[model samples]
Target: MARHIYVHNPFCARKCPYCDFYSVTDNFLCEEFYKAAIKETELIGSVITEDAGTNPLTDPDGKDTVYFGGGTPTVPDSRYICELLGAVRKAFNIASDAEITIEANPSSVTPEKLTEYRQAGFNRISLGVQSLDDEVLKTLGRLHDSKGAIEALKKISEAGFTNISSDLITGVPGETLDGIKRDIGTFKELGVKHISTYSLSIEEGTEFYRRYSGNIEDLVSPELERSMYHGTREYLQKLGYETYEISNSALPGYKSIHNSSYWNSCEYFAIGAGAHGFLNDLRYGHRDDVRAYIEEMNTVTYDTYKAFLEGNESFLKSLYVEERLTREDKMREVPFLRLRTTDGILLDEFKKVFGVEFEDVFADAVKTNLEKGLLERKERTLRLTRSGLDLANIVIEDFL
Candidate 1:
């Protein structure tokens, strides 16, 4: 049972509109989160050991990847980053070449900070360079301007990070296919090894949703959105980038191992406020409230190992949402998640895990899609066609 690890840092300089992930604006209780994060890591370590029947201090199965995702991981002090990584290494058997990544905002990163981060064993850097156009960046409420993003990327490279990934967005109001192409070009020109381009979705409770809720036409039209998506795939493919996942393109071998773990539905450990984890067929999550996490972990009796040993469900319930996944639930997830990648689902692998033939399980769903040419089955793999990619959600829903 190889495991991936995720640690959430809830601090951010500010929240962007059209963003709904758990995060606290400004660096409030950041120090406290760091302390709690360490304790939570110990808790996960004990749980993994208990499940595997191994020593808690030394992980025998070893971690495949570790990711520090956030509100903005780069907003914290470098010492905090170093301490957290050190704690994870102490508690888990991290492989020598484990892909350790930290999400960074350009404005929050400096040359000195990059140096410290690299020295601290963060080999991959995912820069959130939303757009190259200043106006678009402003509309998105990002702290860094185009020049700042370029400078930060250069500093990251100069600091000796080769596995660099950048994030971009399409379907934003006032964005065009040409603009999307330019953004991708800018990332390539800057020598980014990987890029993740997302379609802008105006979720509820966000500033963008409040303003654009009634002004839907201001956003990119569905036809144009499809053009942008197709154009992105074509342009990136021409530039020697592989569209490994729906939103992610990578140059040769620069794919994000940490993220791939999630798409592959591998068991992983998660820590910090609003973090989620899956192991032993159960999913657990911390509440999105950072204050609750800090207050609870700041106590003298905050021994995560003790929490597990005593089966302290009351304390655990206060911190996390737990769910045991059902068989049907797992079956539906396998295809949906795997189809998001270029490799799609390996039929034999799926069968091995579920103890049933893939064809036998999804006969009707597969037959209908294959007839409609939305899906293809070549030997042992089942994948979505180019047209099918656009209607992925609708197609995947058949399984559910």
Candidate 2:
């Protein structure tokens, strides 16, 4: 049922102080991680074969999008990526137009590595160039300077990547509106098709949290952050990039297919440590620990797997169900996720998917938001108002 797959690479060259995502500086586990990923694909494929008659792709297009995401996918050997990709192809029906992407860091990617990735079927490269300002980059603890980030973008484009994306972090400690404009200008000049803007949030356990929690004023004030956010959004839109999602913009037709699958509630396969997927009325993922994941993948018995496939949830081993989704849970989640997109929640589409009218399920929240001018109905879509986008969390939570 899943038309997409995501593989998480947990090995980072060095963990950034601001990142809280599951990652380690250990490179020794890279080989073991890929092996377990391939093995996990095999096990998942075994289950899918029972349902798929002739092809693994359930989409009408007969294609699949495979994404290799952080903690810095480019840090590992390209051969490992190639082998795992080969295994994925064997397990799934990937058509020519399938959008395969790998997220890279400027500090980790090289021209040779980019070529191997392109040859191995990776058509999209998401380069993490968090800032174009040296001072801002330093404050964020990124290894690459502005020069390296620009060079990496050039190398990625040179390696025949037409659908390249670059990231920019707004609201950073030493960031300025001019700096944000400069970063956008650099990305635009480099022919980057997609740009994702992230707001700096100091989560607990990260170095940023330790440094700034006691004196939050060291970071941008709330009003300044808001100004930067709206300014960045408006500027990108003015530059012919559609703000397709809350924090994502793309030049025409360059939106991330794999990420869109998540927002649309389409099921996708998940592999490797910390990767998550939705399937068969459940959300499932392996433990975040690399060693734990490898051990579980290596030790699962045929009987247990068969039992697990048969719906005995207890038989689940290394990969455990995070949540058993109910029909009600799904109805609530649909609007919550869809509202993040520019298209918003399609009223007819909601009924088509859930067998009930959207208004009937969420009349109260919709009416409240509409009254508050936080929601607007454009044609058949219920999208966020300009004010609603700023207070998206509140409106989204109303649906949940």
Candidate 3:
């Protein structure tokens, strides 16, 4: 009954070396995985419907955002994707202006697939462009080159997708500021309204991590990263793109509703292998094993959803982990989460949720940061200034 839903597609045509997301390149498991996902969605809907008014988890207003993210959701056949989307619709009352999105890779997306997705009610398409420099793309282990990515963007736009997003990784090897400018220029030309920028980090368990474990600076120096970060912000703002989050920008009314919901600390239901969700004061996630997820959902009992709601550990012991949190934990987390956005925290909403004024709880922290010029206030909201965003870890730690 959550207002937002996140579906993690675990199939990928090929795994990127820098990606640590739970996904498999085994094409054979694709069909079974999606089928199990459909079955699971139906189970969730039925359980939510049964408990309708009585359950605290219920959100009778219906879902306004459904995000299909993953290891390249377009890797599988379009039929499976479409069928799964249909199952989601059948399971919930999607709002009339719902924003349904799909994450796609350039190498796997096709014109026909785009058409089908458009017809299937996927209003948004997020492309994994990674980098527009061919050498950088190769270094990142992405399957598509700059040319292929551009062509794919054109195809998505031609297929009538106006709400297009492109993901870019800054600080990548062989990337220059001029190259990024060219890429952004290309995106502007091709009608890309949203841009998600990420600084390449060598997370543990990734190929980049192994390759640059000791010499992380060789991958991307801190100074270079800072230059790119600020430069990207300035250029994007100049081009009329609003920097909504620390790493996301959108033109006018094109900001991502689904992603923004996360920044606001909204609870959502997460589906599929390795998907994580937060609801009713509990954070839960499925194991990263796709095969295990498929088997569990396919053989799941009708009481599975109810058990999940009740926190019956025995019912989900094999493939799920539920983290129980206290009221204080949720309260302390909301401000930090909301501060990630440009709009910052709404003081009245904060008080309504926690029954305490924002200043009463953390007046010292706010006063400290404000005195240091790392925080700013606009009428009824408080947010990080440009300096605070640069030193975010320092500012955010005080909240924690």
Candidate 4:
């Protein structure tokens, strides 16, 4: 069995205006609550493994992917995060080549801490450097400027971390097409292995959403956003980066294994406050409240696990209230996610998973999209055209 694990760090030095992830900025609360949460997660994993007739304390096949994702995994005491990784190793079957990834904010990491992370079996680091322009960084309320981001990149490189990735946001307020191109050029110069460029969507309940909800004029225009995305994609491709996913580009053989697990609908275990896990087609998310999560573990019963799997949708809706997906959601999701890769989804695999022919499922919608020259069906695989990629959301929503 392929097992994956995720550790959530709900602590951050500060929250960006566009971020809606579960995080707390109060240092005192974070320092007090994170350790206990980590311990509880270890215990939960132990119990689950015992119940499933598997040994939690030993690696059988050595095939595991552990990911540290959050508001900022590196924001917590480096030692504490290291201990959590140690515990995961003790409690799960981890592969020798397991992909262990940790997410870091450029402002929150140090050269020494990064070196320590490397020693702690963390082979991958993802820096949240949303933009290379100081002005754009400020507009996004990011704590680190371009200089800081470059320094962080240099530190990771010097520490012998070759599998480093950076996050970039396009279409942010006050950003220009030239500025985005400059960011891409800088990334290429830095010799980073992977890049995940996301469009800035004003999520509801976020500070950006509240500030710009009624004022549409303050946001990046649709045409400009498309132009920025197109230019960025072309520029990155020229640098020998493959567009492996919608927002992710990677150097050859450096794609993120842990993130790919989610898109492939593979099983994984989650630990820490607000962390989520999927197993046996059932999903569960931990409580967001740090105190509640720590306490509930001691008292949590088997029924709690059942309730979690069944009730996850409601919790997800409350957290990401605006973008709720449905069962028929696969109509769009299947192609959208598959097209992100060079090897699009196999028709036989889709039939096995969904019990339907891929073409038959979206026959009408596919016909319309092809007529408009937005999609291509070749060699038993379906993919988006260059024009379709620019208007991805529009093409995707047709099946919805």
Top TM-score: which candidate number? 2
Error of 1 at 345 (Å): 1.3
* TM-score to true structure, per model: 0.93, 0.95, 0.95, 0.86
**Tens-place lDDT digits, model 1, residues 252-312:** 9888877887787777777788888776566777789988887766652546545543334
**Alpha-carbon RMSD, candidate 1:** 3.3
Could you tally the backbone clashes for each prediction?
Answer: 0, 0, 0, 1
- State the weakest 10-residue window (summed lDDT) of model 1: 53-62
Candidates ranked by lDDT: 2, 3, 1, 4
- Candidate 4 yields a Cα-based lDDT of 0.76
lDDT of 2 at 116: 94
- Residue 96 lDDT, candidate 2, scale 0-100: 73
Instruction: Report model 3's TM-score to 2 decimal places.
Output: 0.95
Off by over 4 Å in 3: 49-63
Give Cα-based local distance difference scores for all models. Answer: 0.82, 0.85, 0.84, 0.76
What 10-residue stretch in candidate 2 is worst by lDDT? 53-62
Winning model by lDDT: 2
Instruction: Compute the lDDT of residue 24 as modeled in candidate 4.
Output: 80
TM-score-based ranking: 2, 3, 1, 4
C-alpha-based local distance difference test score of model 2: 0.85
Worst lDDT run of 10 residues, candidate 3, spans 51-60
